[model samples]
Target: MQAEGRAPGVREVAAAAGVSRQTVSRVLNDHASIRPETRARVLAAMEELDFRPNRAARMLTTARSRTIGVLASSASSLFGPASSIDAVEDAAREVGYAVTVAHAASLEPFDLGAALDHLRAQAVEGVVVIAPQQRVQDAMAHLALTVPSVTLHGAGDAADEGVFVDQLRGARLATRHLLERGHRRIAHLAGPGDWSEARARREGFLAEMEAAGADAVVSREGDWTAASGAEIGAELVADASITAVFASNDQLALGVLHAARLAGRDVPGDLAVVGFDDIPEAAFFAPPLTTVRQEFAELGRRCVARLVALIEGGDLAFEEPVAPVLVVRESS
Candidate 1:
């Protein structure tokens, strides 16, 4: 057995194969000039020595770690972001790349800088920043990125090297669904005002309302938590004029459901509610939730495809963004 500190190195493998270290390196790197007999001998030597190439050493030679760094925020803990991250990991692995994630303490430049520094030390070929907040975006503008990087969920109108859920369209779908149900005095329970998705969703909600000529524009902000949702949900529907609600996320919608029940309001009878994300538990709610579904799996696949392109020097247009799907349930 190899000692922990004496793991087989390239020199050892080359010696065992009776070849020079350069020959071993070329064989490992698939240089294509090596003869098949020599390659087979090297492979047999590696199997005998159980040699694994040092990643750092390979990085120095090839200038490619073949790894991607993910600088994520609270999104990693949330359903949407977590699902997207899982998708990215799967997609990255499929394309023969490894993923390393660094969660920022906050999206502050200092925090983001620290995460970037960590990934750079690992010699990653590129980075994906899931900057959902404007503050993160603001800090990102001044930071110097040495490797190819792409921002996600933060780009404004311009279609850059990033991807975003079409929140505006999603919000419009939720709002229009309510409007079609004959809900005119509908109120919006939004996530943190600081989030791009939150702002886009709010904008979509208002746009749809105005387009439908619905005069009511009631709205309140929440922290994307059920507690915040419940607290604000109570106040949002207190006026009795609001017959329906469109929450920015499933948690907020759950809060609305709880609040309505506490107020003796029958869901979809006295007050209808809709949420976003279509989280796994959304359907299991007391009444299955009516909500907008962001294609997180697709979101992940595209980010990997885009970032890989950027890394490989390809300026490929990604497959178009998949629009959000509306899941109509008993809630709305």
Candidate 2:
């Protein structure tokens, strides 16, 4: 039994398990040659004693930090980026790696470089860049990285490290949903121009409209805020010919809903709306929003897995771009 108010250690665990210190070490490291019964005994003893191997000691001996660095933008509070960070942390925990985050104040090259310097000081084994803006990507392209890295947003090129969602495909799915419902004249409330996601979504909407030979009204651009959406929505509702609207994100859709109500327009009857991101608040809106759902959980898992592969010098398996799904609701 452990002494009162004292934490248990490996020596006590080995003694309780009737094994040598070397055997306990082998068990902790998951040595393939250890007998199953011996491993089970060591684990049982560890559980009984509440013993945890010292991560710092392990790093010192193995010369591996077992940590991942997340380089994020100041917009980490936003739903998409916040969820991505959470998912990355969960996936890394599952793989026995800790995560350290560094937030850049802006997309400026100096800010990004400072953030990278912070992560480097932590001795992170790999990096996951979570900023979705094009300028950030361009800045990172020029920076020299000493460790392997993966990005959550990009064109999924070889340089992107095979970690991305198909934003264009998701946008097409949202646009097609409105089109199939007989909305010929549609408008798009796009996000900020600097965001790669916004550009892809706008392009997808255009492509889908052209393919269907429908009127594609490229409406005003918004800042991915409900206020911008509402401002754009007021103008959009002015044109009664525009029967449906596809927004770059759910927040914009919410703004549109608000504007439609103020204008006495009936959703689905006078106007249909589709959104992207499928944020949590999207479902509880006055009329539940019909939106495209980005598979953020899968994206995080893939990012960590790809980073791990790069760090370990393993085969880089080419994965297909993460697909998005259309969620139907009363709003559309």
Candidate 3:
């Protein structure tokens, strides 16, 4: 037993388990070479003694913090960013690494640099950047990062440096659904121009429209909010010639639905609408939304796998961008 009023250390646990100090350390670090039975024995010893390994002391000796840093923007309120953060945490834990997150104050280069600096000071072995905007990735490209990094939602601008859902393809799928429904004069409610996903979806909408030889009218950029969608949707429906609308996101699509109802236009009968990001509340929308779904959980797993590969100097195999699914509902 440990001395009165004192906790047992690694040395005591090693003695109790009849293993060397190095073996106990291996079990604590989850080293792959440790035998299953040996690992169990060490764990039992730890539980019996109530011994806790000090992470800082381990880092000092092993130089492995087993931490992955996340640089996030708009994570608190935004669904996509928030989901990505959660998925990343789950995946990292499965691989015996913890996550440290630093939110950027803004997309400015200085702010992003400061966030990265904060992560660096934490001794994170690698970083995953949830960059939804083109400028965020662009800004990070210029910054000097000693550790390996991966970006999300960067639209594949940096070769194999990021993991992302195929926004362009998903947008094309949404636009094509409208075209297939015989909507000739189609309108698009675009997200903000600065966002990479918005730009890709807008381009995809225009491209698909041109390919179908249909007349396409794109509204002024929106702020990815239902209010913005409602305002732009009101204008698009006013044209009377436009019979369908493709919104950049579910929130915007909800606004479009609101505008259509106020304008006395029945959805799919007067105006067919499609949206991206099949958020949880989408199916419960007034008419049930037909939208594109991005598998954020899969994207998160791939991001962690890719980043861990880079951090551990493993094979740098290229990962294909995750595909989005087109879900058809009453809205379209």
User: Whole-model Cα lDDT per candidate?
Assistant: 0.85, 0.90, 0.89
Candidate order by lDDT, decreasing, is 2, 3, 1
TM-score of each: 0.85, 0.96, 0.91
List ranges where model 1 is wrong by over 4 Å.
1-54
- Model 2 TM-score, 2 decimals: 0.96
User: RMSD in angstroms, all models?
Assistant: 3.5, 1.5, 2.5
Q: What's the number of clashes in each of the models?
A: 0, 0, 0
Q: Estimate, for each residue in 246-321, the C-alpha lDDT of model 2 and write its tens digit.
A: 9999999999999999999999789999999999888998899999998888888888888898898974655588
| Residue 330 displacement (Å), model 2 | 0.4
Rank order (by TM-score, best first): 2, 3, 1
Residues 164-191, model 3: lDDT tens digits: 8888899999999998888999999999
Say which prediction, candidate 1 or candidate 3, comes out ahead on TM-score: 3
Question: In terms of lDDT, which candidate is strongest?
Answer: 2
Name the regions of candidate 2 deviating beyond 4 angstroms.
1-4
